[model samples]
Target: MKIQQITKEVSIKRSVDSGTEEQRKTVQQIIRTVREQGDQALFDYTKQFDQVELTSLKVTQEEIDQAYENMKQEHIDIIKEAAANIRKFHEKQLRETWLYADQHGSVLGQKMTPLDSVGVYVPGGTAAYPSSVLMNVMPAKVAGVKRIAMVSPPGKTTSLPDGVLVAANEAGVKEIWKVGGSQAVAALAYGTETIRPVDKIVGPGNIYVALAKREVFGDIDIDMIAGPSEITILADETAIPRELAADLLSQAEHDMRASSVLVTTSQNIAEQTAIEVERQLADLPRYEIAKQSIENYGAIYVADNLFQALDVVNQLAPEHLEVMTKNPFEIVKHIRHAGAIFLGRYSSEPVGDYFAGPNHVLPTNGTARFSSPLSVDDFMKKSSIIAYSEEALQRNYEKIAAFARLEGLEAHARAVEARFK
Candidate 1:
């Protein structure tokens, strides 16, 4: 782990990842092929990338039942518990159609409508997190989306993770596809013979998946172009070094590109945390990955005071932020950015990642500055409503026409003036 003194706020900015040209070109070609060739292109790519020759693109009822049977009872219970939490949390975010009558006898309101269909992409390979399935799908379910389709790679083998399948089943995913990579994204965006096109796609994946989402954005809505996972700890002398180290490693093990940073006011705490992180890193099963992440992207910045430390945290706009200070509530008020905030020593990041009610699909790579976590709203769209009575139209017609004429468009002005006539 690296330790440095923060002279300025900008110095704490995490590394930004804009996809490489070659990666972009490869993803573009895959998207184009999937759009044109449809399921045939999916079969070819699955064989080429996943090395699996699939007889069918859809997961069967028998396979889903088998997935449920294969998982241990405890694991299934945990997934169900997490799903309940996710559902409860997202249900609160559900919106309703609202309208109001104005004094001038006009009605103005917004009609909240759920998307007809949605696609969720879950990353397969060695990284199989059932929590992600819950986070991405439950919101769409809560928003009243009628069809929720999921796509995940079968990996080198033809078997999908039992937990992922079980979680999907619990979340009411209507369709499940056994295709992945850019091809799956394209298939979801532009319907293949086997899979129907969805209105929006949401979830996290590798570089190819990210690029594919970027390519097919206009064709369908995407959650976000997520980058590597990251966490920032704003701690004081009150924070436990061992707990902080564990919190940092929790994200570091996600990927070698993952970032874990500590911004503290105490030099002693900083030194102890660095030592603790090294000790904890040696014990992780993904030690090599965590080590690489810690060595390259992890850092400890010593700030002059709590205010200065928060300044650093805001500038980073980390995906996850933990305030383990003596008075975390006071510190929280100063935090203007960050996708999620965990206050106090007990509120570790993983609690939110797995079982907590909040959606773990958060903004990454400084995107927290303007974006937000995946929620029910992402699965819904809204339309503004305008209904005017004869009198209301008469009252506003001249004003509208004048406004239109001021823009130098006679045709536009005439549209409103015609209503008067």
Candidate 2:
């Protein structure tokens, strides 16, 4: 509710980018216990934590099939429509392994190949995000990954969310497990008796799930270790007050810690936007969460000018950035970092999340400074290929031999030297 001027320096340490240390310690313990006791440990943890009593750790094919029967045709149709959007967007990223031959008939190039398998982690609760299921699986399917597995916690009141199972089925996930939390990550990373270890893991999750992913980096691949959602709006006098308010509240609905900030050159616009936010907040379903987030993490800055506002944006590197200014594209040319940039007044972040082509699994907590959103490239690998004819080997043998000798290993030189001998 308070407005402040943006000086050359930020005063609030620009907010620290870190996970809670206590959460990390708790998650590490979960990972170790699950790794040691396997399914038994997982069941105990699930009952102790999620308050669910499960007979099996894996979601059966019957469960997935029944999920379809319970859903309305219209809801299924929407999932299909969303899947088509996700597939269409990711298809542009598909690639084939390539080879090139020189005039000498020597072949050399990098081979692009899909990873052998990947695991997707979906959070579980009364409300489920079928969108996340599609986002995590469609890209791997697009990349031609052979096996895609899913691990989501089971619900206590009802079965796993129908949309979740339906989306996973539509996206070609090979296996689905009724497990979640750090234990799910450990199972996916280390392989339980029933679940096989996967080449990579991708999805949105809580603090424990994130820390578990962080600990599993070497044993398996993971998507970015994300933090709370954040959105930054860089505007001038031209920014639409009503639209900017909607965008700020969009991210605030994600969590109490999620951040939404409006930085502009015009104080008048800032005040108007704040008023618009208050008006719109009354209607949103998650108003309490959004309000708490805004009260604690939200901010308004009246910069000296558009250039100064843009400078603050670079320092924040928010997960979702909106350019709500005259000539949004013109102003974006100078911007360097953001998980996703919505260039115009009409392009809100939620459109990209539910229906638009790009992935919503973006870096958060200022990680966009160095990381990128999830994509097909995250589910593929490249193997370098090299081949040489005898004549070519003979030409380079002396240099190769010298390089080995310089490293103080004569056996390495002899391996090549013997060929020339």
Candidate 3:
């Protein structure tokens, strides 16, 4: 890895794809087809893309039971533990309806209601992430969502991964479907005869799935147009070179487009960490993917001091940030943006990715600046309540009518006048 001296904080940010015109056009067609043809379009696209003929779109209870029987007991135990952690963390975020009566006897309150249903899209193929099933579904379950519908690509050999099915079952997802890619997203957004339309869709997927989410955004809620996974490490001479290198490669192996960056004040550690990354890269099974990622998007920035490195970290607003300095908490207090922060060397990114209760479905590709991780809050909606007494209405009627008149709305003024009359 090459080292660059930090000159401008803005220069540290990575580039993100908004989507190609061709991708947008194709996704639109998929959305339109699913909207028009429903279940037939889903079947055709599954055969066309996945090359798998499906008798049914929905996963049967028999399959779920078989998944539980086939998966290792230890793996099942771990999924249950992870689900518990996730549920515990999100449980704190739950809110209740509350009302307040003003001095004028006007009442104001907010009613929080969970979304009726949600569609969770888990990617399928070679990679199986039972973790994603837990991360996306558990939060919705904690928020009290009634129907948690899940969709994933049908495996060439099997309809869905046993681990994924087991995890979904553990997370309380009732409906699981063997559909994926843009077509699956389309089916979720618009209803196929078999698949009911959901209030929102939450999960990760390939570019086609992401683009499909972008196209159907207003029609249905989407988690985010997730870009490549990313991780940034702010370390010093005290930080472990091998551990830092290992952490960088962990995210790098996610995809060729994934980014792994290191910002440090120590020159010696920067060079050693770079060498360690190379050493560790050779041992990784996904060496080619990690190597390409490091060569293209990876970087080592030698900053003037810890403060300068902190400035660079905030500028990037990375999806995952690891502070491996001597006083991690002291440094963490200065961080303004990051989807998730791991303090000290022991708190690796994967802890949060798998075991930690906080969501692994984080804002990626610098969207952490404005967005947040998927939480129970994402699965709930709030409606404001206002009830004014006659006394309260009479007192404010003139001001309300005047304000409406200032906006050139005669109907609004008349309504208020009629109330007073």
Q: What is the TM-score of each candidate against the true structure?
A: 0.97, 0.93, 0.97
Q: What is the lDDT of residue 262 in candidate 3?
A: 96
Question: Per-residue lDDT for 1-421 in model 1, tens only?
Answer: 7889888755544566678999999999998888889999999999999989998888888888999888899999999999999999999999999999988889999999999999999999877878889999999999999998899999665868888999999998869999999999999999999899999999988889989899988978999998889999999998899999999999999888899999999999999999999998887999999998998889999999888888889999999999999989988779999999999988999999999889999999888999999999999899999999788989888998889889998898899888767
Candidate 1 lDDT for residue 418: 88
Candidate 3 lDDT: 0.91
Question: Each candidate: what lDDT?
Answer: 0.91, 0.86, 0.91
Judge candidate 2 at residue 2 and give its lDDT: 60
Off by over 4 Å in 1: none
Q: lDDT: which is higher, 2 or 3?
A: 3
The 10-residue segment with the lowest total lDDT in model 3? 9-18
lDDT of 2 at 127: 65
The collision pairs in model 3 are none
Q: 1-421, model 3: which lDDT tens digit per residue?
A: 8888888854544547777999889889988999999988988899999999988888989999998899889999999999999999999999999999999899999999999999999999889999999999999999999998899999886479999999998888888898899998888888888888998999999888988998889988988888889999999999989999999999999998899999999999999999999999998999999999999999999999998899999988999999999999998779999999999989999999999899998888788899999999999999999999888999999999999999999899899889768
For model 1, give the 10-residue run with minimal summed lDDT. Answer: 9-18
